[model samples]
Target: MADPSSQNPTLTTPPPPSSSLSPTPQSGTSELSPPPCSALSFLKTANRPKLRVTSEFDSDSLLFLNKVSCKLFDNLAKLKLSFQNNSQREVSQPQVSFTSKHVSVLYDIEEKNTFIKSNLDVHPRLQLRAIHNVKAQQGEVAMEANLTEPGYSLELSSPVPIGYPRATLKFPLGEISLQEKEDEEEEKQKRVLSVNGILKRQAMNGICTALYTDEELRLRYAYKDDALSFIPSISLPSNAASFAFKRRFSPSDKLSYWYNFDSNMWSAVYKRTYGKDYKFKAGYDSDVRLGWASLWVGDEAGKVKTTPMKMKVQFMLQVPQDDIKSSVLMFRVKKRWDI
Candidate 1:
């Protein structure tokens, strides 16, 4: 406490500023530094399509499902239609059969013969004139020779009745042998048909050319609004032939075709599979088709017999797989038999 003014003369000096301070790192460099990788990232690469994984699902099971889907896709194919005969014969020939051979050919032949016999007595000139007039009105001419009074010329060939003379005679076993022969002949006739029956030639609506079973009858497909439709041909004789048809799809085979069908009652259909069960379905549609019946008689002077025959056409479809079901659309006649 000596003099306060004298103590003020002894004040200390201040310390110097620091020169060793370091510069801060750049913000861009810090942000770009690689981050620590996760355990899952080591297995994931950039090549394949991304796979979703679950705890309970094994990768192998996923791979199996994928493969199955691919196989199924490869097997899917187009649908088609064809025909089969009574001899268990599958013919690729396009034909539509209405009744089976046993029922159709015989019955039709009988019908034709009966019709001819009933009308044979009528004057041919009258019939021809009527037909000719009709054609003339339609602005057309009859291409064949004028049908005139071709008198009762009758001859039965081929399917002729057997043992006519002998069977009629009275003998010990004559009746029994005749009966046996008759049965044999009947069976033979039922089994035999014209391998290449006369083709009924006709021009349909100009779309598809139909090859008729009994004759050359051509039906056409009518195309409208990206849909294919059927147009039946005009038959010369209404009772000439019968038609039949079927449709099927082979997703695995890639096939689709239709033969002779006077009607559109059959169709090829498909559906989505239910599951691993591989279930399927099918269906058919009814579309009318036109056909005809024919009878031919030869000139009377030469003694020619008219062989009247009826042809049956059948249509069917098949698939390779066994697990498919079929659903039908509708069976209808787009056209009718034209006489």
Candidate 2:
């Protein structure tokens, strides 16, 4: 990186003879000549800031976690096996994921809710991630496993939570000022503060901060009443100088809106509940332009449910093209049992 302030060789010119100097009209001092920068300005103007696209996912789609919980293995003492698919794909292209949790309601070894949740990803690449939830009455300490994906380079992490108090004052247009500076080296990242027990886990807590670099994580801060919250965070990679806005009218209300934005992109989403087991979401983004609005109507609807098991069957009409003859008929059935 050569300094732009340095003089350029192509712009240099020989000085005129002293005898050719003309007296200044306003002062005794000789009139200063034009700066060398004017001639070599093209060399500096050639450099331009590069444009960057941050996120790869820029579409509007429905995302749901398909999970089945079974207690058939309760003979193993509160041991449960759960298989979940965490991918956003067509029903024909579902992914594979598994989880196992050992929980005790009355065991006082750690707490009444002493539980260990572990997840394993078997396909695409074998990976494992686990969290230890050591909860008490007021505060809980969570320890995360330091594991890496199967095919990636060796990832060794020793996660130590360095918790602290963070205060934020919000301004309009998603601009914020922080007192506790973002971590400089990003060596030992801390965990973000959460109000899961306090606030019903509706917010993604760290919002009113800046992401200094790629190593520094851009955390989502949870918002409280009057658009105020005190949350801490661990460093994650993000664009610099981004802002988030959170607003909730009431504490007991489940409806909330969150908008996060930086220079490159922005996104906003709001979720509301109709009744107990039904909820819908409406959102828009700068990306995900409107595609052809497709619709599906059919007569395949049957579900059977009891206290211990559930079964559902549906037939969907998939039309990738505008022509009706090109549509494909699909049938799906799901069944699960509990003991």
Candidate 3:
């Protein structure tokens, strides 16, 4: 009699809403979500292709060209086009080259020349290299062995076209240590002595080398230190002697002088570098009675290894003391790119 609906409390209570635990149909998602079209368009842009080109220019009378090169196939190959003056040449020369870790091949379209080089790592301390010229139908094979424990190296090279073989041996003599006394600075310098011996086959008499002799043997001694280097060389039978010296004033400044007793000629050069981007050189030759000054705008050798692209510019002036009118001013610009 106490009301049946009041006795059943569960039945009297209203049912809980279904949308409490899950999102409702009209409400949107609460978590972060990326736009559908943005991801697809981003991938398309990232996979797009690109092209790269390199070029060079020169203002000289060396019968050269203004060359441009295009990289392809992930930079494993290059196609080059060389342009020259119409008065000098008719058509541009095209060149192609392919390179890999152990081999390289190059071909010239106009000259119909091909060059191939292969390097083999036979052992940890031994290496072999072979070079072939298609046009000349000639080849050369070279081997190098390094004995690090004794500080000795051996190199042998032989020509396939001709029976000319050569061998060179290099070894360290000893080292002398010296200390400098200064008020505020103390430095230790090492004087390293090394020797080089070269032996050539008798058939190589007609070939030109540093020293020519009937015994086909040459010896050179090198002494190097932190700030000074001296190299004295002599040949057997001919006994032709040459001396070279280099003095370094600082890390960026140096002077080099060399004299050849066999030719009775001497040459000297002074070089100064301004940071890593600029270099200046002045040189004089007694044999030619010529003096030259050169300015380099970039570190050609240093940058090539670390950069994918680089530009180099060089300005040179040559003065012949005997004939001032024969003086020449030359400049060259080179740029390279990798794609």
Candidate 4:
């Protein structure tokens, strides 16, 4: 017998190739990474702040205050809440936004600072804002306008349909000046009155002052894709104008240039980063009137374990200014803890 069963063999087929359209699932935390952008993009973002609590400890302030023996409110605790509706497709109900923050000196438990704000969409094109800044008092009803002071402020804005411009009207009620010295002193604690109306469009934005000034204009452009940008703006009734350019050559290298046309002055800056935790910037400004150079270094680190905490510190130096002819040294630090 020549093993007839073994001679007759079975044929097995291989599996089909995996499609490139779908990502393969992995066992661990293997999520897709985020998209890439320029090194300076983060500085330009008008990011809507999120809800969080921050506990800060400023070592420089601590040292300076200790040196001067005027330590009052250095260490701080801050709580901020911000919420908004980011949906675009659904437009049935009114869109809304809320933001509030409370800040207090850790050492002084009684004194506190608070800011409450709200934005509501009256319609698809109309929006309203209300903001207040007054600490809560026991058994006292907080009114829309602070009874002791006019701390209430409002803003109304109407944005045109997509592809159009936006307009805003600001009513700084808290900014009103008083006639009497007592009234002025009372209103001094509140926000100063500087009402304005603004019209904004892509690449161009303008502002018209209500209580003062004629107008302000801004123009922006990108000189290179993901690499360079230039912004120029001028203010009227003051004859002030500025033009600036920014460049991000790589993840670790950046540069910027700024010019004050009215002053006939210009400045240039360069920045570099190392790994993920360190960054340094150096720059110089020179003109027919004045010139100086400066440098800054900052670092941040975090640990996400029990009693979560974060710390940030920065050191800065500037050369020659304001009668005295010597380099000035400055230091700042901040630390945060979860509540």
Best by TM-score: 3
- For this target, which candidate reaches the highest lDDT against the unseen true structure? 3
State TM-scores per candidate. 0.16, 0.28, 0.59, 0.41
* TM-score, cand. 3 vs. native: 0.59
lDDT of 4 by residue, 1-339 (tens): 011112233366964676797677767644454335633564334222222333332332342211001111222222222121222322222211221233221121233444344455555444445444445321111112222323333332222221112222223321322211122467365534333343333333332222332224333333444776766666655667787788899978999999998878888888887765566777776752333443322344343122223445567666644544656566665444332
Q: How many Å off is the CA of 258 in candidate 2?
A: 5.3
Give the distance in Å from residue 2's predicted Cα in candidate 1 to where it truly belongs. 99
What lDDT does candidate 3 reach at residue 325? 97
lDDT tens readout by residue for model 1, 176-269: 1111123345735443222211222233533333344443443433332222333334443453332332222333222122333344344333
Query: Candidate 4: misplaced stretches above 4 Å?
Result: 1-197, 200-224, 236-239, 286-309, 321-325
Worst 10 residues of 4 by lDDT: 64-73
Model 4 earns a TM-score of 0.41
Q: Name the lDDT value of residue 157 in candidate 4.
A: 28
Clashing pairs in 3: none
- To one decimal, what is the Cα RMSD in angstroms of model 4 from the true structure? 22.2
Where in model 2 is the C-alpha error above 4 Å? Answer: 1-74, 77-214, 217-223, 226-239, 250-264, 290-336
Which residue pairs in candidate 2 have backbone atoms (N, alpha carbon, C) closer than 3 angstroms, thus clashing? 205-220, 205-221, 205-222, 206-220, 206-221, 207-221, 216-236, 217-235, 217-236, 217-237
Candidate 4, residue 16: the lDDT equals 67
Task: Please count the clashing residue pairs in each candidate, in the order shown.
Answer: 48, 10, 0, 4
